[model samples]
Target: MATPSSPFSFLGDLFNTIGERLQPPDWAVHEIQNRAVLFLNHVLQQEPEAQQRLLRQQGRVVRFQWRFVTMELVATPAGLLDLAPAGSVPELTLTVTDDSPFDIARAALRGDKPAVQIIGDVQLAAEVNWLVDHVRWDVEDDLARVIGDVPAHTLGNAVRRVVGALRQFVGSRTAGKAGGSAVGPAGNAE
Candidate 1:
């Protein structure tokens, strides 16, 4: 797992099942690519460069001579994957990954979400941040709806797993902070 957790069995079992379901089948790679790429292409309509590249691929992949232009919708052993464009992960500039589709969806559903915000001392790039800021979490529902057509229902399950895992993470953090003062800073005081 990319993130670690205590032995408590909050979401581990659920996420494990979701991961299993998310792996594209041996013959389903093409379908998976079509679905994922098309959604991304639609979302990226504002970005002409990426949209052009995506259109050329028929919602699968297109390899241009330049490394920057070639993208592979590869289903490697590490689950469904996409070789995104260089600027795809603009949020990496902050090195914080607290955001997730589930979080965005819940926040927006509750009507307290903002379109954009600054963090620390960094100014997120205007274009990329603008894209992020404009992307509504309802789009997440759209993605999930599209994935519903797939035989495996991978994205749907993954979203559920993510929400469950996040709940577990919050519970763990709360339990640790609320109960650990009695044990002092370290787990033990030799």
Candidate 2:
């Protein structure tokens, strides 16, 4: 008897093919980068220690690359991040090692950091690592500002549960593949 393949297995290949062939326009990429910078600044502002740490690295550029996309950000004197000017040389470069979006997403959902290749200034890399270890966006607080505290808390709990379920499901699937035993949703080997 032959095992059935997942219906969604083609999605990974489909996405990779599309990504390789279809590059977004420069203007759109720039706009998205600007918005990302804005969001980063907002999160940094919420953490005073993070700001002070970034302030220590003022004017230093950090470049992040994943596949074909890259973004460079410079630490400002005010402790916020801004998009680095085009052609600006970076003190540190961090490239995500994962080539597949599905793998990256799975790792993230499992609360694992994607492997990264770091090159450049040691101190800058340390600072970036510290920021990564410490800085997290308080989505619940942001949501509370829009909706009420109770609703935000409830929504946050719901989302967390859903994410937890996804993490378990992904973990089981990975384990089943590796161990050569199919694991059902209830986590029993079939």
Candidate 3:
């Protein structure tokens, strides 16, 4: 008896309430953003080529947007990322094309790329694409540094297995939603 928009409307209201309740203080949000930048720089450091690319992009800014969230990052000469100053214009902007965070997470878990809309500089976009295609976090290596190599290897393997299982389960559920056959990201039955 419920209308098609009912569920979506409920979800929207629920998210709004949650967002209002979970909103952090300005300082805490700034700190979290700084930490994210540090983590990104850490990952960038792992790949010399990526670092070099970023270095080449020094002084340029890239704005990223995912629905209501927005962050503008500036490329530092040291091949690191820093939060851009307020009101700074970005050389390029990357907008996540997907509206659903659940779908984005599922696609990421499946090792698939989320759709994006690129605006502005082509060179900057290409450099960003290269960084995305190349940079990866070596979680196992970091774990090994904290714990031990053997434990880290075992943990990493276990995590990978669990992720694989989840991917399969989620994929199957999505397929079921699409009439019992696997559906591509483009909604094509596969």
Candidate 4:
């Protein structure tokens, strides 16, 4: 089984820093657990810490909702943690769904929490592969927020941002001296 989240790893330090900030109402603690494993693939893009990260991210989104109890993985050093309530999970229609490894992984990283759950009947367009899973929802929603409606161009923009972030992240992980960093001998490949 996986360990607790890296984000929460710093919670002790965090709470200590703001211990006297505010106390929540008793009723506020009553929440339902609505988290999952795949939604985090987009945020981390590593595809390994699916459950721990995605579930946390999910928890965060639903936290402020009427039935809040989900965590989410933000693309920061500290992975999954508390998220604001997501309200109702939106219903997005996936063109494909077969529940295969890729399908499962996609759903794991892409399915909405009780929202647009990608089933095994829909199909995935090749272009969809370019996006990070967690950010996909935000990317989709962001475009919808900016433009009165989602045009073909907006979808491209979202994908572009996801790809850019992914490339930048991966680049840093594998960057060289030319990239403004040098790999230590232990960090370098044999």
Candidate 5:
């Protein structure tokens, strides 16, 4: 008889095979990175303190690495970030140390920071850390700009409730997986 995990394992392997066969083109990757930079700058613009910090570090480049992917961004004089020119050296580099995507996603869902190794400028590192810790995307406000305040608020509340339920479910599953027993909402183990 097939185990409960067999289907998931097969799906994972299938996805990996597909991913290996279909690598995104360079232009597609570059466009995606540019979009990410634009989104990041939009969020940064909403936070004056974060913008000021970036302004102070203007012209400094930060490189982020996760597995095979790398992104290089430089702080601009306007207190925004832009993709660093190809072949430009970064002043600082941060490499994600955790190898498992599942573990990284779990940590993110738990509001925990993923492990990373930082190399180079300490001041720049500190500023970046501060930004990570304090700055948040104002998703509801952005939604309100499109859908109006009341609908945005309703949607935000709905999202929060769903996220809360998901967190609880994931937490329970994690605990159960670690303990070798299913955990219930009331904290009972079976």
Candidate 6:
């Protein structure tokens, strides 16, 4: 007897098909890339060391690719990021190896980095890895600037709890599918 197929597998295929067929307008993609650069700059500004490191690599472009989407960013002299000029060649390219969105999300929720294939400048890639390891956004602090500290703390705690619950649920589901071993938050089998 053949094993039953997953009921939700079709949804993944449907989403992939739709995503491939329906490309966003170039203008919208440009605007979104601009916003992403702004947000990245904002986060970089919070870490002086990150900015200093980036400043050292000024003019070097880094390209990120996932599926059909690609974004290229160049380091500025001021230690901030900006969109690379069209047709600019990247010194380093980082491509996410994972093709499934759900798997990516699951890995993220489990506090794991998705598999990535790195190509090009080793120094640039090392700097980028350092930035990723050191820099983090203080979401609660940002929220507190708009609201009050007490409310922001409470909300942050709630959000953390919800995320923890989601992590647990996803872990359990994955474990059920893969025998009995569960993957922990660190992506190690438990």
Query: For this target, which candidate reaches the highest TM-score against the unseen true structure?
Result: 2
Q: State each candidate's clash count.
A: 0, 0, 0, 29, 0, 0
Encode model 2's per-residue lDDT on 1-190: one tens digit a residue: 7766554557877888899999999999999999999999999999999999999999999999999999999999999999999889998999999887878998998788999999999999999999998999999999999998999999999999999899998887788778888867687755
Per-residue CA lDDT of model 6 for 76-155, tens digit only, reads 99999999999999999999998888889989998888999999999999999999889999899999999989999999
Cα lDDT tens digits, model 4, 48-68, are 444344443342222111112
lDDT of each: 0.43, 0.92, 0.87, 0.39, 0.88, 0.92
* Model 1, CA-based lDDT: 0.43
In candidate 5, stretches whose alpha carbon ends up further than 4 angstroms from where it belongs are 1-16, 183-190
User: Runs in model 6 with CA error above 4 Å?
Assistant: 180-190
What global local distance difference test value does model 5 have?
0.88
Task: Spell out the clash pairs found in candidate 1.
Answer: none
Write the residue-wise lDDT of candidate 5 on 35-122 in tens digits.
Answer: 9999999999999999999999999999999866789999999999999998988889999987656667778877779999999999
Q: Write candidate 1's Cα lDDT for 1-190 as tens digits.
A: 3544534344545655665567656457556546766665455654554433333333232221111122344212322225444334222222223233344454444343433433322332343344455643344446556655553356667876877776665555556666753333466521
The C-alpha TM-scores of every prediction are 0.30, 0.91, 0.83, 0.24, 0.86, 0.89
Candidate 3 minimal-lDDT segment of 10 residues: 1-10
The full ranking of all candidates by TM-score, starting with the best, is: 2, 6, 5, 3, 1, 4
Clashing residue pairs found in predicted model 5: none
Off by over 4 Å in 2: 1-9, 184-190
Better TM-score candidate (1, 5): 5
C-alpha positional error of residue 83 in candidate 1 after TM-score superposition, expressed in Å: 5.5
Worst ten in a row by lDDT for model 6 = 1-10
Local accuracy of candidate 3 as per-residue lDDT tens digits, 45-147: 8899898888999999999998767889999989889999989999999999887666678898877889999999999999999888889999999999999
Q: Local error of candidate 4 at 2, Å?
A: 31
